[model samples]
Target: MPVSPAYRPDPRFFDLGPDYADAVKAAEFPKHILRHRNDRAAAEVGLETLSDAEWIAHLGRFEPLPGQPGPIAMRYHGHQFRTYNPDLGDGRGFLAAQMRQVDASVDRPQATSARGASDRLRLMDLGTKGSGTTPWSRMGDGRLTLKGGVREVLAAAMLEAQGVPTSRALSLVETGEALERGDEPSPTRSAVLVRLSHSHVRFGTFQRAAYHQRADQIETLVEHVRALYHPQVQPGDAPGLLAAIVEASARLTARWIAAGFVHGVLNTDNLNVTGESFDYGPWRFLPHYEPGFTAAYFDQFGLYAFARQPEAVFWNLTQLAGCLKLVADAGPLTDALNGFGPAYIRHLRTAFLDRLGVKSLGEAADQRLVDTTLALLRDKGEAVRWEPLFFDWFGGFSSSARALSGPRGKVWQGEAFDAFRFALFEHEPECPERLENPVFARPDPEEMLIDEVEAIWAAIDADDDWSIFKSKLARIEAARTGYGLG
Candidate 1:
């Protein structure tokens, strides 16, 4: 195993003791065909140098990294569709490994300072999906459909490109198995997915402690989270911890709105304490701006619809606050929970502006731009696609000529966009140079609509042809580079 120097294993979650998780073994599969490998993410954790065989041996077969212990199945309970489920846990996956990785957002110069090094490097986790069954399997087979893995990989890539804080799909290995899933075609293929994320500590982690009436465990959990993720907060400041999560989660929700993403399930377990999106199940990117559009077929009431996402997130925050009440004052927790509305509004403004690639004229003007843009999108109905509107008008008025002549030009020419056009022209482009990227020159933007996703999977399923999937990923990478939204 030729591991890079950047590989620094730190299995910190084990410090929480046996109550939080149980050590588990990966299931033996018949095959280990590599479907996708994220070399970019591998480099971050110093595993990029591994050969395909080595990669399969480690990620596919779940061989523990050097100095790393076996996989640990984390335990927690969460609300599924607002219904409390005590049996919910990592039924199919486990926290395989933990390590420190360079935070690319930090400046190298500042990294030399005493506090800078720690800030520059973040603790990342390698968590598995469809790897195997665990104590929490509950009589169900621990398997992930191949289509599910592909969808998640695509979702993670597009979300990252859109500057949304999300987990990176590190690896996907097709295991030789046939599984029957009611939602999809019978006897579908199976694969194991590995995700690289900031932390696996979910909102449900705290809920579990509170549910058990273990206030002492809640207190310890608070300390552990604050020490690793939010060091700025005082040791006993549980309310402050809740506030940090609230702010991050608010910003994340706003980003999802700007990206036209409907996270089909916004369950407490799906949302980590770090506010980074992960465990994507039945996620969808909007084709058009429709508030009532939903991603999951089972969401009969549209509780987590496109427009209702903000409300759903706020509700989840209150759940977390309820758990915090076990160790902290209710007044402070409620105050922190109340911050979601204001924080969401502020973040929505920033997120929309960033997506539009425009500089904010001022708070008032920016709000108008956001408001008018959404109004125009709503007005246009199905006549316009969501991503192309941003793609065409990126950099505001600077790209007006291009936007007016693009494929959606006819829609833009209508009277409905008059106010939106005026609002957009009021601001200048933030990164004018990004307009030169070849991705923006194309007639259409790269989109991950449901139809396109099905097409890509169809190619793979019918003929084992991965060209469409690979090409789409390449286009997404190009778009990510061109947008330069980060």
Candidate 2:
């Protein structure tokens, strides 16, 4: 038998280099490398052969880079639920390392890993819990709790399985350190998270640079984003680069909506310039379609509510556009703004239709059914109830199919729906077999918010009884894979 090529990590991402110590005062996690291993898939990668120490050393290696900010800090400002906040940067997290052009087979995007590359943007950051302050720590301890780490892992994994583009957890290790906090009982424990994704640059990053009037840095950061995520831009097409960013953002927000996910916070700092979803906390997945369902306890105004997400994204983009105006003209930028609505609508429609296994709305009636269902979901506050509808109908041939087509068809025949339905299915193929009755077998309302999920995790941590947690994960994973989200 022929010998295989020596196993290696993606060459592209082989240490893109980090701008370490550029802004060192902002660094809290003293350069300490923690040893870790791939308990999951080291075998497949042929990395199982590495001794434990070898793996740990590889995981712990941190190379500093030229021109990299000491804190990996970029400049930008952002709105917190529509309020202008001129002060914000990596308040707690710091860019620990950067792997350039890492080939992540998982996302199929050759970009720096968010957490670190195991086919994801693998990034390592020390989530400070009272790590004693930084430029962005505001008035509180920057410490994050162990419970918070657990919650973030669940949120990121759950959302990712649900077809939501989100941060992936590579590691979550408790730091044996104490810190004070008002949010939690004092002497908080900390954790480190290694995220996998394309990039971690945020709307806040751009906002910070813009706020400081560092137009040169803004331009540099824009180029960095483009080079990493949207390298298709021709030599002189800066406007195209901006538009590409806008388009990516639009598609991302649309996916969040289709998956029934509410980010809870769309703060400029939380909005990823790479158009990736970041900073998961107080996030909620709708059990029922409630327009006012708020995820964050702090979001008392529901600014990042389920229904307002798209609007929030558009608004964020407008803020980003303002920053871009420092360098670009107004006219083409206006064109980019106009693209958000239609592009988002198109993305949502395609993704939603795909989940239903509806090849095309072949008739106005078919369109009306979906439209009516969505309306009812929104009005009655029951979006999660529709999940089974997708499973039943799209699974093909069930009692629910008859309910969808026979008596229930009258909904589409109604005045408002009649014309819309006709136009919808006119050009599409019909899948009568795919229709299913919207029967809800369970009486209890479904919920998947951070707090609700934390309850399940509590059991896992306390008793290590993971039966319930495993079942929930299975159901959500089934939903994702069934709909091809996985």
Candidate 3:
């Protein structure tokens, strides 16, 4: 196993003082059943070398990695359902560790030699949900139901497969315990989940400082973020950090919309500073391109509905901008916040094309294509669903006419699809050979609908059956490959 020097860990969150975090220990469980492990992500942090037992000990047992001392529950406050709540923090989760991931995604600059890999690295945080309790437990058990853990596992995988910038479920271990919950059956299963994300610091992290009138801490946070996440942001460049975060947030919002995912909760605390989507509680993929689609059963006002996602994201960005007011002037922060509209539109158009597996003809033609496609989906309404339409015409104008003539082709009629076809024909295909896979040869693409997800859970609940869940993951992987997104 090869390790990169990027594995160097710098424990910075503890610098915020004990007010920000409480050192915590993992709960002892009767059993540690390894359910899912993302080797791909493990490889990024130089941990793919660990054996299964060692992996469980490190992730599940909370054994501190090299340079990591212990876990700390971060402090923050956020507006839950638009009401500011100071009681909120990592009630059931904590930052387990932080490491630099060797990122091979960047292009080499002329200043570097071409023989070696690009030394650029991305900072990653190991966030464990339902691991144990800390100062912010709030009188609730700090354990996750096994079914809830499974649901989150599926949610992260599906989102990643659809090209969304999302946190990955690194490891899941069943802590042989019976958990009683009102949402599901009583005495339901229990487990621990570990999520690997770019950063655990949320917009609300700064909110807490602002709430306590701690401008100095806010400025310190700004400097910390600038040094770690955005080196391009020079010293005392508050506006530059805001712009970088805004751009990332804009892209994230657009990607979620393009993927047809409704993150039921868009609260500031759940919104990461790095702009990667994590902390999935109540999330859903739209059955169709319905704007009124709501994911949370308790979200009565549709605040975080499918169509209102971009709005909610921008609103969170505003709250983040408000925190930046402590260090930066209001003028430049407002200017950066105001850029979200145009940035969202631009990113949405590009993301829409990318999701459909098509290359852009140019800005004008691509925007036209995006507009027509969305217009068609809106007009079709209940007559068409989201996943199948893309599955039916993945290659756009050059999609298999024969494949369309099958069950998926039944709805390929009408003026809505006609407009889409004409607009799509203007652009070249991104990966035409993607349709050649046997997965695409089938009638339906891999979809993560509510019923399908429930059915998967039912299997787990009955006789410890995991075949359905495993096969579903396999199918989703095949779909990801079929879309040429792997």
User: Which candidate ranks first by lDDT, i.e. highest?
Assistant: 1
In candidate 1, how many Å is residue 457 off? 0.6
**Tens-place lDDT digits, model 3, residues 1-486:** 233333446466756678677888888778899988888778777677678888888888888876776999999999888889999888888899876665555432322121224324677789998888778889889999988899898999898888889999898898889998887788998889999899888999999999998988888888878877877889878888888898889999999988889999999999987889998888999988788899999999999999999999989989989988988899999999989899988999888888777888888888887888788788778777787777777777677584478685667767877878888887787878776789867877788999999999998898788899889888888877777767
Each prediction's total of clashing residue pairs, residues at least 3 apart in sequence or on different chains, is: 0, 49, 0
TM-score of candidate 3 relative to the true fold: 0.94
Would you list the rank order by lDDT, best first?
1, 3, 2
- Deviation from native of the Cα of residue 33 in model 1, angstroms: 0.4
lDDT values for all models = 0.90, 0.55, 0.83
Better of 1 and 2 by lDDT: 1
**Model 1 agreement with the true structure over 307-411: per-residue lDDT tens digits:** 999999999999999999998999999999999999999999999899999988898999999999998898988888899888999999889889888888878
Output the number of the TM-score-best candidate. 1
Candidates in descending TM-score order: 1, 3, 2
RMSD of 3: 3.6
The segments of candidate 3 whose C-alpha lies over 4 angstroms from its true place after superposition are 1-8, 103-119, 400-403
User: Distance from true position, residue 317, model 3, in Å?
Assistant: 0.9
Better of 2 and 3 by lDDT: 3
lDDT of 2 at 455: 79
Q: Lowest summed-lDDT stretch of 10 residues in model 1?
A: 107-116
* Lowest-sum lDDT 10-residue window in model 3: 107-116
